[model samples]
Target: MQFMEDLKHLLDISYPIIQAPMLGVTTPAMVAAVANAGGLGCLPLGGLSPEKSLALVKETKAKTSKPFAVNLFAHSLTSEVSEEDIKIMENYLEALHKKYNLPFEHKPISSYRFYNHHDQIDILLDEQVPIVSFTFGLPEAQILSQLRERGVKAIGTATSIKEAALLDKAGMDAIVVQGIEAGGHRGSFIDKEPLPQVGLISLVPQVVDTVSVPVIAAGGIFDHRTIKAVFTLGAAGAQLGSYFLAAEESAASEVYKERVLSSTDTSTELTQAFTGKWARGIGNSFMEEMKNSGLVIPYYTYQNSLTAALRDFGKSGGIADIISLWAGQSASQSKSGSTEALFNKLIQQIKSDTNPIF
Candidate 1:
């Protein structure tokens, strides 16, 4: 229990486990279930407006008094694409839209708005949320200092040891060592090209050795064996995302859940078709079509917007082929159940393995 002890003092959790802050998938019910089950549940605020983010925070608080974390996308804001860029993307998506019987009319782009980490930070401080975490990049010195000043624990995601050290230097309370096996967008902090695809077993210990702060292991970690491995490697806790996608309380669409459950060993791939940034998801018709068409669109947020209508259409029509079924390599291990049941099962398994026979 020493591993859980360390994490509890830092994150105020009854269990060392923390649910990964899954954007667009983790629901209030999911978060509450995890918290109620003694692990820290994270609610992602990456895509929400400031007001909406505050409302979510309030709703989460209403559901559970146990500590939780809120995650934000710490990226710089850029202009909406030029007319030419939009047209280019539109043309590329046109054939696929028609093929999929999706909406062809280009929806008017919302004025590009960047996540105001500062404003969200202020909101967190006001709410006195116990933990705040970020991905994509680190915050300004002032932001780090302010969080520390207010006693809010801050964690950052890193895809490399260098990024982990940088996060420690930037005053992060802990660093999530996001291995290559992680689902969704890759949180490459410094490197332009991908780092050697380090697995969790190797990456966690390396990051722990490099950084002075606590290392939380992520990526493809599903069962108690993987959890025990990370702890043995010196990770203070384990963060999991893909498993929650199948939790009954998860906000993931029914179609998305079915696709994940039906996935074979070769079902997933890393592609940037949906969000522009490289992310792992179940290989589907859209991904196959993109490969055949051979068109790489803009970076994440932009491409995400471009495919927004398609994703919406897929969701509304109960079609899983067009939606992004974000998941990790161990996604095949996911079993559909209530969040409480899943959390208890995982916790029980960890306890049984770690317990000493008299």
Candidate 2:
């Protein structure tokens, strides 16, 4: 278990388990709870303004003195959205809005502008977050350098061995091998027609073999068995997100949590219908209807902004079908309750094994 020991030492946590930094779902309380319970807690700051990211960091620190990580979206925030593209998507969304009896309007170009991660990096450095991880792609070399100069550990997400090798060469302390079964957005940064489709079992060992940095397996990993399976696959640790969607501290609405808890392996599918990026979520009427409409979805941030109001309406009205219910393939195995209880149960389950990895 040298890999496990090395990972724990590197993260300064008692366990190698990392609570995935699930944006829109993870809260300061959940981060603190995981950090306090002997695992690495990650506050997802991807898509948030610098001010809000800093506030959440401060709030998490107020709850726990333990080390935790923060994540950022390293993808390009800006894209040229042609008027034709905008009109096409708007027209499609307008129909959905009318069906829902919701207000529909045009969004200006500035509405899609997101606060870049470079600005957010200043907050991380200021707060002295122990670890920083990014998804979608690697950050600028200078950003990674600044983090290292500050003695902060950096982790990167990769869906293929090529991406993992790039991050390792870039001096990342760790790499999350995000398998295809992972929930949320596909972390495939390389420009290709089809995304990488490796499963966790196939991905972890390859990334582990390809990268010099510690490999953390992510994707459809839910319980103690899956955690152990990843370790056996040569992963130093496991990064789990969907497993926590039902945690009491999660920001997911009641309806969303209910959907996650009730869903089976077959309930979810990968689609670009919502955010214009390939993300796995429980399939619903919105995704189905949008697919049937045949309007090409815009790129992330653009399509994300266009659908923001409808998602807000769905969330506020406790409507399950409209909101994106992001979850891993094994989401049915997820447990419900407080994070502390969930962690304790997971720990107990692992220890119950006659020869435990941790």
Candidate 3:
């Protein structure tokens, strides 16, 4: 009860459900809809420029007066791309381009030096965003301090107890414990050869116990059943991304939405083919081909830039085989409708249940 009260007070929201910030897929309308529905909607600025982030924050504010959050990719960037690996991927992508009759370009990759969060923070402070969240890793200490002084609450993502403890020590208002079942990029900041494979069932309570900050459960949580399950495990809240993938406000294309709707329990797999970082998504030709090629996958930013064209082509053409169709294991249970309708339905389901957890 204290956990729920503290989280709701800290976020200034009626409910503790967070609409996970699926960068590129999250739009202002979707975020606003969730916030208007009493949940915290998140505008994801993971790879967007500061100018773009500013515009989006303004747009979301215009749409809703309720509290919401902005998410950023705080991963430490490196310009240490392997030439041999890049060339190999180039060759592979070139072949795929020709096969698909798509245009190919060997543009120079940008340095990681220009990808820091300094500019984004300035925009957030200027806009006075109510909340901010980070993925990949935590933001710098100075940035966190500035956010605190300005009355902006910060949430951090962690895939293990170690990361949760670190975020708790770093003064995170709340920490989202992302299980392996989470779709999209793994929020792993630690240098583990193999990422942690803990499921939501096993990871939630451990991180809840490890952190003094409120623990928000993420991954594989869809409906009221899962929400109540997580609360029973001591989570103050649950963050759902894949559950909203099919919402009408979602930025996912028709094909992408359809893929999420049809996904089965065994339909998803963890692959880095799309972003050069491990992520869960529906299996596709691109993932399989890249996994079978034996070519060393380049790290993020580089690998993401290299494959952008093909993904764009696939998206424009409505060809689902080549594009990234990120979804959780429970995607098959998703509902396709307006974000407000879906969000309200979840809340109603929770409140009306005989043993309500909210």
lDDT tens digits by residue: candidate 3, 185-281: 8898886546877898899999888889899999999999999999999999999999999999999988999898888989999999988889999
RMSD of 1: 2.3
**Model 2 alpha-carbon miss at residue 157, Å:** 0.2
TM-score of 2: 0.98
lDDT of 3: 0.89
**Candidate 2 structure quality by residue, lDDT tens digits, 1-358:** 8888889999999988989999889999999999999999999998889999999999999999999999998987655667788788998889889988999888676555586688799889988999999998889899999999999999999998888998999999999999989989988888654688889899888888888878999999888899999999999989999999999999999999999989998999999988988999999989998899888888887888889999999999999888988888988887889998888788888999888876
lDDT of 2 at 43: 95
lDDT of 1 by residue, 1-358 (tens): 4544666789987788889999889987889889998898999998578899999999999999988899987776663456666677788888778977766776556665546576588888999998989997888889888889989899999888778888989889888898888878887756356644677888888888888777889998888888887888888889999878888988889999888787766678888788877788898888887777766466657788788889988898898888988988888888899999988988888768745210
TM-score of each candidate structure, all chains considered together: 0.93, 0.98, 0.97
Query: Which residue pairs overlap in candidate 1's backbone?
Result: 275-300
Model 3 CA deviation exceeding 4 Å by range: 110-114
Could you give me the TM-score of model 3 versus the true structure?
0.97
C-alpha root-mean-square deviation, each candidate: 2.3, 1.1, 1.3
Clashes of 2: 0
